[model samples]
Target: MPSEPAPPSSSLAERVARLEARQEIEELKYRYLRACDHKDPEAFRACFIREGADIDYGELGTFATVDDLVTLFERIALARHNEGHLVLDMHHGVHPEITFLSSTEATGRWTLRFRQLNLAEETERVLCGDYDDRYVVEDGAWRLAKHHFRSLWSLTRPLPKGYVVDEGAHL
Candidate 1:
């Protein structure tokens, strides 16, 4: 039997650089999700590029600029009702697949397990989706250039009467 071909080798510096880039991109995704859950519009906006970003959140809306998305996000996530937030959200991102297209550009795919509580409507929603993203190094940091989310499934149900939710100290 013929011996298997040798795998390509990269220098230690190159390997380390690639690893660091991947870590930064992963952190970026985490920050984005956390910002959404926490209703931090500034942090959420910081995760994407300054301009000309392509964002498509399906039924939520499509935006050419990060600012546009931020506006809508503020309206929905920051709404107040009865001395409490109108909507509460939790985002859990998993199964990240990051692929490097170049030293300064990359693509990532992630699965999002999202849950939301609408206090005004007394509904609980659960959704699962896939995020297809493009990242680029801008001003020495990785920022999202393209973000598209395709929802796989979602369910919404009315909360039981007299149900109580403990928001905890975090809220």
Candidate 2:
């Protein structure tokens, strides 16, 4: 087989930078998901810019700043806990396609599989969606500039009747 010519050093450098950006963005996403499932609104808020961050979670209401989302998250999560409900949530992001429009800006698409079990309500919900996100470099760190998702499919069903539910609040 004929050997291919090596690319210029600049090309290689760009490639490396893109790869690093992708990894960093992926880690940022994981952090956001973990914070959400763990019900840590503060950690979740850290994943985005403190101000002027846009968030639209469909029926969950749209917000102009990360603080709005954080407040809503805390209120809903605390309400669930106080209602004797166990909220088990799982977020799986897959098939990410990220494009770097500039050194400081990028866009990404991801498929998300989200499942939630509300023990007090005896309901299990599964949601499949796509996240359309925009990123920006802020203070030398990549932060979520805009985050939105659309649900492609979802299902909710009741659990077995008369089943006992455990309060696994202390995880």
Candidate 3:
């Protein structure tokens, strides 16, 4: 048999640190998605840096600050119709490709599977997109420094008459 292959060049500590950082970053992305689905503006805002973040969501608009994005998020996501939420959203982020540029800086790309219900318009939309993100350590935590979303495709159609959605005790 051939001689044993050489081990990785990085030390155990360095490898562990990198793994932990990746886990934190992935959790951050999931939290952001959960906030969107739950309509929690505070949680959503917490995902990004406090200021001066490059955010682009295509037709939804772009912002240089988290405040601007939160303002718009509140206007649309918090709207109500017929004593129920005006819009319901679900976000599934998958196939993350993360790379480290430094111990405290990294980049990630994710595929997004999105679904939305518009109560006011009686329409449903299914969309697929890609997210390009930059992450940095701020105040000892990973935060989104740059976020860009490009929609690959979307399908929107009117909901059938007499159809209803029951939240069933979950918001």
In terms of lDDT, the best-performing candidate is: 1
**Tens digit of lDDT per residue, candidate 2, span 1-171?**
101232466487676777787788988998988988888888898899868887899878899778888898887665555536467788998888787778788888889999988776779899999999999999988999989989999999998778765656574
Tens-digit lDDT track for model 3 on 96-170?
988888889989999999999998889999999999999999999999999999999999999998998875466
| Model 3 spans with C-alpha error above 4 angstroms | 1-7
Instruction: Give RMSD to native, each candidate.
Output: 4.3, 4.5, 4.4
> In model 2, where is the ten-residue run with the lowest total lDDT?
1-10
The 10 consecutive residues of candidate 1 with the worst lDDT sum are 1-10
Which ten-residue region of model 3 has the weakest summed lDDT?
Answer: 1-10
lDDT of 3: 0.90
Taken over the whole model, the C-alpha lDDT of each candidate is 0.91, 0.81, 0.90
The better candidate by lDDT, 1 or 2, is: 1
What TM-score number comes out for model 3?
Answer: 0.93
